[model samples]
Target: MDSGLENIVAAETVLSDVDGQAGRLIIRGWPVETLAADKPYAAVLGLLWDGFFPELGDDAEIQAQLGRARAAAFALVGTFPMESGVVEALRTGWSLLNDSEAFDDAIAFPAAAAVFTAAAVRHGQGLPLIAPDPALSQAQDLLRMMRGTPASDAEARALDAYLATVSDHGLNASTFAARVIASTRAGLGSAVLGGISALKGPLHGGAPGPVLDMVDDIGTPDAAERWIDAALARGERLMGFGHRVYRVRDPRADALKAAVSKLPGTAGRIAFAEHIETVVLQRLARKYPNRRLETNVEFYTAVLLEALDIPREAFTAIFATGRVLGWIAHASEQIGEKRIVRPKSVYRGPVPEYA
Candidate 1:
């Protein structure tokens, strides 16, 4: 049995594909680079959900539907308590959603995901939840809600790039969890809930905050090599340097690095991160020449999200805002399948005869 299911093919999807060998990612038919650079979050969502739904419309129409859904989700902001964690608070907002089996739920889940995340960020700062503006795009509305004002064009575009860049990948852990729930004939609520739970694991979506922490620890480009060397000597896993998949550089890294670079006031941080990245790669090469532990998505994901004024604790929630679209589409894709996704296990424990 493959313990980690490495190189295992589980489910077939038309949503996205990850070519780890060549370091490429295709979402629907569009390359991730173009999606990040040229498309809005709504356009990518439209692409992913095009044929999966009965009446998925043009990009502008989809944006309108999601706007209504976001407005609907914003109505429940003050109804829920601020939980110990931001994700929990976000989940609480989603739990209030009505009609999980309805077609509107698909649109509502992502709408709610973004709205709740922005609300959670504001609540954490001892601020009130700002109501959604139906006129603004999804990215703009989210930033507006979080900041309690109009988001600049640059801020909205950067978030759009980030959300679209991470909209989907080839059957990741959270996606697999979502599909498993969907396969069990569970409704969309259960599927999305399961996805969020899997994404909360630090090994999966919790590294970005610490990537910034690493940058803060190093303080300057000159200190990067020494800091990384000392950390490596202590056997601490470098947070952003490697990935479980991606034998080459993760394609998402460059996509997000470009997005982060385009934002205003990030030039110095980008330069510093570039220096640290170079030092870390050189050291990692000298240490483990056989392994391709290059920069992964989290390396620049931290840079992008940090520059967005998003707090570390809210990163996973914000990631969920984008990925919930994938969850909904995948669940819709599995509607006709009857398989229960039961994998046989090999028991190695002492199986003595019970006379």
Candidate 2:
């Protein structure tokens, strides 16, 4: 048996393709770079959910519906545990969703993510929760709700790009969890909760936070090379330099790096990060010539989110806001398959022998 199931092809989907060797990502026939540039999160949602939800008309309508969903989800924020961390409070918030219908859950899950994320962050800081505005786009409203003020056009666009960039990928850990629940005919909200639970694991959704830690530790571009060498000498894994799937540079890295560069007042940080990145690559190349260790999405994810003034504690929740769309789409596809996901196991322990 293949213990890790790395070689297994579990399901067929028209959602997205992840090419590790080539370091390319395509979602619904559009390259990730193309989709992320100038496309709003609502538009990406429209592309992923097309033909699945008949009620969703166009990008504008989907944005409006999502806005309404966020507003509806806001009323339930009182039930969310105020004392818990943002992710936990988000879990409580999502657990309270209506799971009776897929269509409703489809709209509600993503909407709730943004609302609960903002509310949880505000509650943790002892600040008042901001209500959702139904007319605002998802990215704009998410930032507005979090900060209790409107985001600038560039800030909103950068956030929208981030949301679209991470909307979907092939069956990674969380998306696979979502599909497994959906295969059992569980409601979309339940499936999405499974995704969230999986994402909560440090192995999946924990890298971006530490990228900032690494940057802070390095302190200066001139010190980065020596710092990286020392870290590697201690057998510490450079957090953002490698990915499980990608042998080449992650395409999403460039996408986010570009987004970060366009934002105002990020020039110094960008240069420092680029220096650190260059040193890391050079050292890795010299240390292990055979391995392809390049920058991954986590590196710039930290940069962009930090630039947006988002608290590092809320990184994964922000990620969930974007990735919930993928979870919903994959759950719907798995539900349509009408077959449960079941794999065989090899028995290694005690076996019975009959005469």
Candidate 3:
């Protein structure tokens, strides 16, 4: 049995493909770069959910529906106490969704995720909770509610690109978890809850926050090389330099790095991050030439979100905000197949003795 399930093919999908050796990502017949470069977050959702939800018509209609959904999600904010971080609050918010219908959950899950995450952030800062703006795009509205003002076009676009880049990927851990729940004929809300819970694990969604920690500890461009050398010498795993799926550079990294570069007032930070990346990659190459330890999505995810003024702790929550759409879409696909996902395992333990 393959303990890690490495190189195992479990299911077929039309959503996205990860060509690890080629360092390419294709989402719904479009490259990730193309989607992130031009399309807004809602448009990506349109692509994913197309033909699945006939009720969603043009982009205008889709955006309007999402706006109303956000309003609906806002109505439920503060219903639960923020006893923990935003991710947990988001999971709770997802649980509170009464949507059993796939399309309904598709609309409500992202809406509730954004609202709950923003509300949780505000609660942590002792600031009054802000309402979702029905007139704004998902990315724009998220920033507006968090900062209590409209985000600049560049700022909104940065988040939009990030959302697009991560919207869907081939059968990832969280997506697989979501699809498993959906295969059980569970509703979309239940599937997305499973996705959110799986994403909270460090091996999945927790690295982006720690990438910021790595940058903060490195402190400066001049110090990056030495710190990386010491970290490698001590056998500490570099936070964002490698990926489990992508054997080469993560395509999402370049997509997000470009987005971060376009943001205002981030030149110095970008240059410094570039230097640290250069040093880390060079050291990694020398340390293990056979393994592809190139930079991954989490590295640039931290940079872009930090430039967006999001707190490090909220990183995973925002990732959930972007990824929830993909989860619902996958669930819808799984539900359509009418097959429950179950795999047999080898019995390695000693045979039971019978009298």
Candidate 4:
């Protein structure tokens, strides 16, 4: 048996594909780069939820519905414990949602993620939560809710790109969890909770924050090479240099790098990150010529989020906001199949010898 199910082909999907060797990602029918650059978060949601949600209409309609959903989710901000971790608070808030298997219920997961995430951030900073504005786009409202003011168009656009870029990929760990729960005929809320639980794991959605920490630890462009080299010599894996998949550079990395480049007041950080990225790539090449260890999404994810003034601690929760769309779509697809995901396991434990 393949312990990790690496070679196993589970369920087929029309949502997204990941080509590890080519380092490509396709969502619905569009390449991640193209989709992320062109479409807003609402458009991507509309694309993903087209056949799943009967009421999901055009991008404008989806935006309006999502805006209302965010406002509805914000009503639970008072229930979340400020002492709990952001993700834990998010989970608590999500648990309170009605599991009616309705389109509005499914949409509430992403909406709640953004609302709870923004509220959690403010709570940590000893500030009151901002109410969601039903008029603003999801990305703009998310930023506004966090900062209590509107984000610049470029900033909101950069965040929109990020959300769209990471909306869906192949069946990742969290997505697989979501599909498994969905296969069991659980409601959308249950599936989303499964996905969020999986994302809380460090190996999955927790890398972006550490990438920022690594960069901050390096401090300067000139110091990057030495810091990385020393870390490598000590057998510490660089946080953002390699990926479990993606034989070459991650496509999302370039997408987010471009987004970061378009933002104002980020030139110095971007230049420093580029220099360090070059050094890391060169050093990695010299060290392991056989392995395709290259920059992954987390590298630029850190850069872009930091540029947006997002706290490092909230990076993973922010990831959930984007990825919740994929979870809902995949769950709906799995539900349509009407098949429970159950695989036989090999029992290597000692069998009882009974007479």
Error of 2 at 15 (Å): 0.4
Q: For each candidate, how many residue pairs have backbone atoms clashing (under 3 Å)?
A: 0, 0, 0, 0
How much lDDT does each candidate structure score?
0.86, 0.90, 0.88, 0.90
Q: Deviation in angstroms for 158 in model 1?
A: 0.8
lDDT (10s digit) by residue, model 2, range 43-136 = 9888898878888778888888898899999999897586869888888899999874457667998898899999988988889989999999
TM-score against truth, every candidate:
0.97, 0.98, 0.98, 0.98
Task: List all candidate RMSDs to the true structure.
Answer: 1.3, 1.0, 1.1, 1.0
Order of candidate numbers by lDDT, starting with the best:
4, 2, 3, 1
Expressed as tens digits, the lDDT of each residue in 18-79 for candidate 1 is 88889999999899999999999889888888887877788898899889989898888789
What is the Cα-based lDDT of residue 36 in candidate 1? 93
> Compared to the true structure, candidate 2 yields what TM-score?
0.98
Error of 1 at 110 (Å): 0.6
Residue 163 alpha-carbon offset, candidate 4, angstroms? 0.6
